[model samples]
Target: MRYDFLIIGSGITGTMIARELSKYDAKTIVLEKENDAANHATSANSAIIHSGYDPDPGSLKAKLNVEGNLLYDVLEKELDIPLYNNGAFMVAHDKDEEGLLQRYYERAKTNGVPGVEILDQQQARALEKNLADDVTKVLNLPSTKVTYPWEVAIAALENAVDNGVSFAKNKQVVSITADNEGYTVKTEDGTTYHTRYVINAAGAYTEKIAKMIEKKVPYHITPRKGEYMILDRRVAGFIQRTLYPTPDEKGKGILMVPQYHGNILIGPNSEHQASLDDVSTSKGGLKIVKEGALKLAKNIPFHKNIRTFSGVRASSSHKDFYIKESLEHSGFIHVAGIDSPGLTAAPAIAKYVVDTIIRPKETLIDNKTFNPCRKAITLYDDMSAEEKSVAFQSDARYGNLVCKCERVTEGDIVRHIHRSVNADSVKAVKKRSRAGAGLCQGGYCEHQVIKILAREFGKTPLEINYFSDQSNILKNETKVKK
Candidate 1:
């Protein structure tokens, strides 16, 4: 197939870039190696919307993060994604930590961060009553927020498709060769796609993608694996705002994020890994996470942790995010070095690429009729007294609960499965609908979702998958018994 542009990843950056480019009249195609968007780093992180307080002054991360934070209000409304400005509290342990925080406060001031201030122990405690008493000092970033990283990516990518962008899932780009006017990319599935431009948004493999074009991309991605713990909805209101630790040379300390739903997330142990694919949480890493969580709230009850998992960050080999045009190659752009603030910086990055890269092109034409709004299903929590009556009267599936833990309705799961690519995997469905993200994890609805998959895709429940290519489910009725 021919395309004006070919994107090399399905992570958030690729998805957002596709969404950005779709505002024009270009024919684009996004290739995802995985069955779903945000399967790697996008969905793996803690979902923190950073407030541009940590990166070095005037860096790409700083500029983009600051701009991205401001863009969320309109972006969320236009995209129909949920966002919570749960504010972050960076607590200090002692005078030494307080001294370090002073530097960060100054840096934030220099970066023009709004709502950056120091709060006494009493003030911090009042902000979040569950904070440990020893938190004598705190830096309050009132602009800090939380969002569903996976949902944003999914919506953006599908929105791009709605605007004429094509998607080719399971089409892993194995090699790239430059041609007379453009590039020819070959996938593992033996199909070839030709495009004039290529964008490297592969999270951990961004460097590898550049190597395909024989350009020596300088950044090295170190995998920083972060293990997270999800508490039950009953513990959602334990803290009124997100909590963080003071920034230092060791990197930003652990964080407590309040999800948009009535639940809490504790986690993201930052440990460097040797392999890019080493996203598995180690025993020691999780122990550190538990200890960190207890430090914030001693009553967090690690026993209530129904989910423990990890995601690898494409940690910058250098200092800041690298989003620049390749001097060595034309039509090749680098979007590597996306770490903690990448999600917050994504929208700004999209704008930057558009202005610096796309707008200058002679062929690029603006569609005056472009509509940024997307029609997403926001009825999960939007069902008020009147809306519930109207919905339930129209469909019985809305009343049938499939995931009791997350309050996911049968209708929600069915729609998510139909909308999501390769709707056979539990992991795929979760990324789309938050199906198993609640207290019981998948213990309550994994079987039910598999049955739904069986009915939708004409497969037996036994053949259903925990995730793509990971099926080991036991057949409900044994053939030997029959």
Candidate 2:
């Protein structure tokens, strides 16, 4: 089918663009390579909405990050996603680090970031008691926030799909050829899509996708891996705000991120990788995270660490965000090399792409029926007794708790499975509903989730995958079915 816009990836940037374009009367479609959306870098990260202080003064990361940080006030309300605006602290361990904090404060002012100030050690320690003993000063950024990164992508894409945008999974674009009318994007599965404007937001694969059409792409993208650790919810209140250990050349060093869903996240030590697929965490990488996290906050319950994972960032040779139309290909837009602060800048980036870049070139009418609101998944634990009774009356599955750690009910999992962007895999379900993302890490509830998925998808337990198509949880049936 010919579309007005064909988005190459389903990450936060692509999905946000899709959601923005859905407000127009254009035929937009988002193509994802994996079996689900946001399975890569978007799903794994620090999940911090940066305050726009770290990026250089006149860069796109600075301009869009400040704008995007403010847009979340409306996005969280419209999309029904939880956003924790608890703010962050950039701790300065000594006098030298205090100088760096002052420089960041000036940069924040230059970038038009609001509500930034430096607090003395006594005042800083008053706000957060877990600071390291050597802390001399703190740079307070009240605009910073935390959220469920993957859930934001999912919510945006789901709202986009509901507003007439099409989304397809497992559609890896292998080749792109320009024609008189438009471009033909052919996937690995022999499927072809004809679109006038192609948006290359393919995260780590952005450079490769650009090379398919333009022989001499201006920039090269190398995948940089950042390993992270998630502490159990029991340690959620250990820190009230995201804590940073100042800035370094590698990127924002290890941070103590208070995730929106009552979990503490740490690590994300940066290291360049030769391959984009190398998201594997190492003992050495994790050791750096453990030691670095100690500098920001003392007496952290390391025993509460529940999971360790890594995400690959699309680091470009340009040293800044490469956002512009291809000089050789008129309609092709490249939103590449969006590494750090990419999550915080996504909303503004989408607006710029749709309103500034695309609209001036092409005439687009408003989609009159577009609705920004997406129905939020009900958390059984958050419901009142009366609400719970009403939910149980409507669906008996509401009474059955599938995930004891998170208090997720069968009804919650089923609703996510039947949403606009369905959760077909165990990981997808976990991202949307937090069914298996608790202390036990799915040990107690994975089998039950598999059973539910089998019944809902009309397949046997062996067919239910953990995330990818090849990573099936059940290798074979142990016994004969009755």
Top candidate on TM-score is 2
Q: Report lDDT per candidate.
A: 0.80, 0.91
Error of model 2, residue 265, in angstroms: 0.6
The numbered model that scores best in lDDT is 2
- Per-residue lDDT over 1-482 for candidate 1, one digit per residue giving the tens place of the 0 to 100 score: 67888998988788888988888888889998876677888987878788888888978888988888888877788888879988888888899989977988998887778989999988787778889877888888889888888888888887888777888876789999889878899998899999888888898888878888855777878777888878776776888788887754557767788888867888878888788877677788878877787666646755666777788888877769888778887887788888878888888888887788766764677755667888677445457888877877887788888887778887877777776234557887877777887777778888888888789889777776664454546545756553
Evaluated at residue 385, the lDDT of candidate 1 is 88
Model 1 TM-score relative to the real fold = 0.94
Candidate 1 least-lDDT 10 residues: 467-476
Counting clashing residue pairs in each candidate, in order, gives 0, 0
Count of clashes in candidate 1: 0
**In angstroms, how far off is 14's CA in candidate 1?**
0.9
What TM-scores do the predictions have? 0.94, 0.98
Clashes of 2: 0
Candidate 2, residues 203-301: lDDT per residue as tens digits?
989999999999789899978899989988988788999999888988889999988878899988999889987888899999999999989989989
